[model samples]
Target: MKREIVLLAMFTMAIIFMAGCKQHGTPKPRGYYRIAFPEHDYKPFNKKSPYTFDLPVYTEVGDGAQPQTREKYWYNINYPNLNGILHISYKAVDNNLNEMLEDSRKLAYKHSVKADAIAERLFISADKNVYGTLFDIKGDAASPVQFYLTDSVRNFVRGSLYFNSVPNKDSLAPVIDFVKTDIVHLMETFEWKEMPKL
Candidate 1:
């Protein structure tokens, strides 16, 4: 009788355990946290510089934070909440327009090893005298976007976007898209300040 009782209990426990775990376990895929992006808005950049543009309200402009002495008119448009920055460098055309254009191309193409592809788009505004190329770099490379704006006569400027964190294209796609719009806006509103007559 005792043996039968023990056998019955063992059977009952086995049945309960089997019923509790009826389904097979499956692994869950990894996911990234959702980011709440802010509304896109712009205000005219109010700094003393050779050129002017409408910058996103979410940014603050400051001198470049480099170890070496920074050049005049070189500034950084900082994205405080996003941990990103747009480095802006200005140069007088000085009859070296070809050299400057080549340099910009080299700078953008340097990331091509890590980048999947790079798209070059021409930007021209005869009214504003802003003519240059905008490079949209794709992949897990640094400086996903870079551009050079120049009147092709007197003023030339270059801008590059970078983030403080590691470059993860999958995770950063949304933020990158968000910031790309602002860069386009800056380009759209770019205008060179009138030079004083010598």
Candidate 2:
């Protein structure tokens, strides 16, 4: 009877070992958190400013030239929900159009080390006399978008998009695309303010 009890215990142990060795497939890849995007509705920003454009209603326009000296028309489109900001700076053309254009190009290329590619798309509105180039940067660059709108004679406005968090192109792709559309809308509605007589 004792011998039979020992054999039964061994058999049970063997069955448990066989059950633990069943096939297990490879581990699944990690995933990122889902982001909730707001509606794409926008409103005209035709306030008492040097220029006017349409911006998303979800954002706020604030002075970007503060803490140094508040310049004439330097502002930022703040995206509180997405932790991002679009810095816009206006410069009056005073025989420095070439230099200004060069500066804008250099600024966009600064991220070439980290960016996989930089695409420049020309924008022109003959009726509005708006002309500019939009820079769409790919990869893990700090700033994914930079653009400049100019009348090519008297007004030059440069804008750049930056995030408050770490640079992760893959994770930020959706937000970047959404903001890109808004930026394009802004360029479409952009108009330069007439300079006062000197």
Candidate 3:
């Protein structure tokens, strides 16, 4: 009887081991929170700013927060849901167009230490007489996008995009791609609202 009991216990242990072997546990793959993107719709930024562009419906235009931005026609395009801001600084192109252009280049390149790559795309709209360069910065940079628009005579506007959260290229990839499209739309529709006097 004792021998039968031992045999029964061994059989039960064998069944349990076989059952456990049939199913394997795996660690869940790392993941990020699912993002709900807004529909793409834009309205004209018809405010009294020196320039005008079509702004995405999701954004709000407000005065810039930097001290240097004060009284400089600087503005911030705030994304409430995305927790991002696009800083726009407008400067009249007196005789400092060269300086402004160089400054913009410098600002965009400042992220080179953290960025894997920096791409410059030339923008030209001969009919509107608006020309500029858009800087697309990739990797873990603080600012992922920077651009400058100029009539090459009267107006120069520089813009940089920054997220309110920590910079994580992998996690922010989707949001970055989405916002990049909006920035391109803004640039494509950009125009000088006021003509310079001769």
Candidate 4:
């Protein structure tokens, strides 16, 4: 009888333990996540850095890499380390500068639609209203170059680029800010292709 009672008690205890083990509601997994960013070992542009701020040597000015339709005219600077590319262009818009800024927000959303992460990105305020885009390897290879369009006769400019990876916005903030500084420098140095001096 005692043996039978002990077995019964054990069974009851097991039942209670199992019941407790069974999650009452939705159970979450157990694990820790780590987010690590690389160290910043960058160099400034070799040519006269018409603009301020030091750009990474991993970045280099390249020939017109973007197609013609992208904008009237645009150029690219390769960011090989980050496996990224920065494409910049100028396009005249019918609307004014304010309207362009509003539209820029829409453009960013449109670009993010196809990407996985927002990546390091932001707006250009140090100089003018130049919309910027940075990407992280999220999906099939995407154009790392961000395209910006402006109507401000005072400063009609557009800039775009693609990041090597689908970068998280929070993590890339510093880098993006640094890139923006260079872009501002680019704007200052921006000289419309000499129109044959006609």
Candidate 5:
């Protein structure tokens, strides 16, 4: 009789264990995204002549998505390593250098609806004084954007995209830090020849 009872208890315990295991199935491990940058590679500046620089291998350039707009030059660069797309744009705001500078400044750091925008300063280079500002929007609507620009005569600029899934700005600190130096390198390497009159 004791042997029979022991066998029954063991079966009951096994069943309970199996049920519990199913009830709390082990979770698939979360993905860990490490920061991996590609070896430097690049092509000559497409729009401007007399400038050359290297960008990461994985980066790609494409025609700007918006064409009907008034912007002069617009290009899209996909940075897969960063899981985002960056937009490089140029537009003649007012044809005045000072006005352009002011507009860029406003785009960098003004956010009120009535105002232009808001950007967080990330890095600045000494030689070209290239500065970076992160433009962050809020909500499920859209995380925000990142844009770095220079008032240099040729109107050079660069930008990057983030996954938007996790955008603490703190979490993005690593890539932002890495790319800022790259941006400065690009700015310093920048050279623009006067466009020949048509």
Candidate 6:
């Protein structure tokens, strides 16, 4: 009788274990953490510089120009909370307009290897006399947005957005889109300052 009771208990335990091991349905895919974005309130960045634009109230501008390599007008629009920076460089066109445009195109395309697609939008402001192109890069590229604004004359400005962390488009998409709107606002309010004659 003890032997039979032991067998029944073992059988019951085995059935319970098998039932526990059976899955209910298909497993859901992995998910990432949620991101919180700030409001889009902006303030004018009209410092004593070669150009002026509207930057997000949450951002701070720093000198991006290095003593060794970068020019005087290079600046970085830093998003501290978002961990991203938009490097803006200014160059005066003495006659190298074509070369400058070519270089801008090349710099933007360098990410094409990792980028899924690059969409170019031509920006022409007849009132502001600003003519240039904005490059929106899709995918896991290091720099997902790059643009160059020129009067097609004297002032040429190139800006590229980069994050401090690893390039994960899926995770950074919200941040990128948020910053992109700020950039668009910058572009809309962008104006060239009159450079002093050297």
Top TM-score model = 6
Q: Write one digit per residue (lDDT tens) for candidate 5, span 81-173.
A: 676666666543235656655665565444344323343555555464444444543322122455555544444555544453554454565
Q: Per-residue lDDT tens digits of candidate 1, residues 66-129?
A: 6586566888999999999999998877899999999999999999999999999999999988
Each model's TM-score? 0.87, 0.89, 0.88, 0.43, 0.54, 0.91
- Once fitted onto the true fold, the runs of candidate 3 whose alpha carbons sit more than 4 angstroms away are 11-25, 65-69, 195-198
Q: Rank the candidates by TM-score, best first.
A: 6, 2, 3, 1, 5, 4
- Better-scoring candidate (TM-score), 3 or 6: 6
For every candidate, C-alpha RMSD to the true structure in Å: 2.6, 2.2, 2.6, 7.7, 6.4, 1.9
Consecutive 10-residue window with the lowest summed lDDT within model 4: 189-198
Q: Per-residue lDDT tens digits of candidate 3, residues 1-198?
A: 999999999999999999999997999988999999999999999666778999999899998747753555678899899999999888888899899999999999999999999999999999998999999999999999999999998899899999999999999999999999999999999988765342
| lDDT per residue (tens digit) for residues 89-172 in model 2 | 988889999999999999999999999999999999988889999999999999999999999898889999999989998889
Q: Which pairs clash (backbone N, Cα, C closer than 3 Å) in model 6?
A: none
lDDT string for model 4 (70-171, tens) is 433445677655456776544454457677665655555565655565554443443533334333323332442344433244334455656666555544
Model 2 worst lDDT run, 10 consecutive residues: 189-198
Which lDDT value does model 5 have at 28?
94
lDDT for position 40 in model 5: 53
Candidate 4, superposed: residue stretches over 4 Å from native: 2-6, 9-13, 22-54, 66-74, 90-157, 164-198
After superposition, candidate 1 runs with Cα above 4 Å error? 1-24, 65-70, 196-198
Against the correct fold, how does model 2 do in TM-score? 0.89
Error of 1 at 185 (Å): 0.3
Backbone clashes in model 4? 15
What lDDT, from 0 to 1, does candidate 3 have? 0.91
